[model samples]
Target: MSDKKKEIDLEEIIAKYRPVVGFRVKKSLGAANPDWEDVANEIMLNVVEKIKKGEFRGESSIGTFIYTITSRRIVDYIRQKSKVLRHAPEPKPLPSPHEQIEDKERAELIAGAIKKLKPKYRETLYLYYYRDLSRKEVAQKLGISLRRVSERVNYSQKLLRKLIKK
Candidate 1:
């Protein structure tokens, strides 16, 4: 293919995979930062440009390429933020004495209950419930099958219910 044709083909592939890239980045970064969508868009644009410039040859599928680039961007963003925070002055401590006391107490109770569960159950619950991951997402993150995620979640819920009833 001509250089221009190659560039166009890369752009078309990127366009087709944009939604998938956005969804993956949004899911991975949304909880950490509300500005994640903008970050994801910026990262996607950079990835497209790199692909068009022949920097990222299509050794992987378009979707995988976008996902890998987006993942790296997120990691780099987080590392940069951490470095900034490390160099910045610490913030003032809270002045209020009783802020979120009830919430903290409830959270402690729930955490104690979770600690009583099996390791797999606890991990599954923490990832799916506390981390707010969907079943499929949880499976993907944990490197488990979707069926295993479903089973673990169901079993964990039953175990928790039984423990709570006592």
Candidate 2:
């Protein structure tokens, strides 16, 4: 059928199918369900839209076509309604005041120790740790041997520990 003719037929089909569609939806979803009207309306809308789009194919009568659409839509609605809600993770609690003060004091001790290191050891540590350079890269940048870079990093760590202890 032509598009214009199909559109007319669809409207007539909707008018005739309205009662059957309402009965099918109300029976399946129950009249007490607040969304019964919405589901019934959705089925009718699907029937009209599919018929207009030439999905009917003229093989089945309009009643059968609407019946199939209503049944499938009801199944889909139930599946959607019965789905599970996902669980959320709980948030972490705040740290105690003692932890906050200890963290601040430790940070101060580390800062003082770093400032007391000689310039070469400080440069080596800055490149290797803070700037995240490889030992070879730190050696090449500082014009020192790889062995010298490793020694400086280890020795600086020992010195910092001693200074912090004092």
Candidate 3:
């Protein structure tokens, strides 16, 4: 049979099990969250897509597979929502002029110490820490290996500490 025919058949099977699996997963999530139908639809969609991609290795029963995927998807949803809620920033009072001036001086001192570093160390620090690039990204940008970037960052920190202590 053609792949399309297989997909339609599989989809029908999934639909047959949807209500039972959806009810089980939804009950675990309690009330006041996404509706059961929506969660079930998303779980079915995910399973279907994974099936199409040949990601189902057939190491587990179909029911077990559905249960694991549904559980993980629900956990992922909770984590995503919790992340946003946990990171919600509260307002803070502005710093005083004296505090601002002190911060500026500290930044200037740090900059001067950075300047004293060798070019390799300086550029690595600037890109990885100042620019907030990941180590892999820094390696790509600087044409170096991930290990080399890590070495540079570590050595630069030590060198900067020595320089700043003077």
Candidate 4:
């Protein structure tokens, strides 16, 4: 797009800097990584725009200016690629119908086991395991002592195992 901006002699700049910029990009980023033509074109466009806008003040030689732009672009490209690789999302697996069925059956079995439990044991199991509450939290919620909550949870697990086995 900047090539269409007719303020500077783009052809002269391309002729002088294409080889230097292209070679630098290929050598630094490896020829196998990206198309050399694309890198060369980007460098040419940037240099042309910078010179036109007076950003490339006469403090540095033309070669140094071209090299700086080329090197910075290459570095930026690599950093962007590295970030993409590092933060790439993990693939999620879909559950098979068989797995879903088995999970449902397991939930039904646990529900039946919990239903068979006495009220105190059922309350303990529901709060401590199903609701994922800590023993102290369960005790506070049920207005019971911490030791009583712990005892109930231990007894409820044993009772649940026996009920599920049947």
lDDT of each: 0.76, 0.85, 0.80, 0.80
Q: Is candidate 1 or 3 superior in TM-score?
A: 1
Residue ranges of candidate 3 with Cα displaced over 4 Å: 1-5, 86-166
> What TM-scores do the predictions have?
0.46, 0.48, 0.44, 0.45
Clashes by residue pair, model 4: none
The candidate that wins on TM-score is: 2
Q: Write the per-residue lDDT of candidate 2 for residues 12-115, one digit (tens) a residue.
A: 87788888889888899776565777899988888877876778886887678788999999999887766621344335445568977999899998988999
TM-score for predicted model 1 compared with the true structure: 0.46
**How many clashes does the backbone of model 3 have?**
0
Which pairs in model 2 have colliding backbones?
Answer: none
Write model 3 residue lDDT over 1-166, tens digit each, in one string.
Answer: 4688768868785877788677876786654344456777888888887777777767897778777988898888777757876888435444468977998898898889989889988889889888999999999999999999999888888887888788
What stretches of model 2 exceed 4 Å from their correct place? 84-166
> What's the number of clashes in each of the models?
0, 0, 0, 0
- Candidate 2 is scored at a TM of 0.48
> Lowest summed-lDDT stretch of 10 residues in model 3?
28-37
lDDT for position 129 in model 4: 85
Rank ordering of all candidates by TM-score, starting from the highest: 2, 1, 4, 3
Candidate 4 lDDT tens digits, 1-166: 2546544556767887788888888887676554456777887888888887878766888778888888889888778768876989435444568978998898999788889889988888888888999989999999999999988878877887888887
Tens digit of per-residue lDDT, candidate 1, span 1-166: 4788877876787677767777776786653454566776788788878876777666887667777788898788778767987889545444335745876786776667778998888888889989998988999988999999989988877887777567
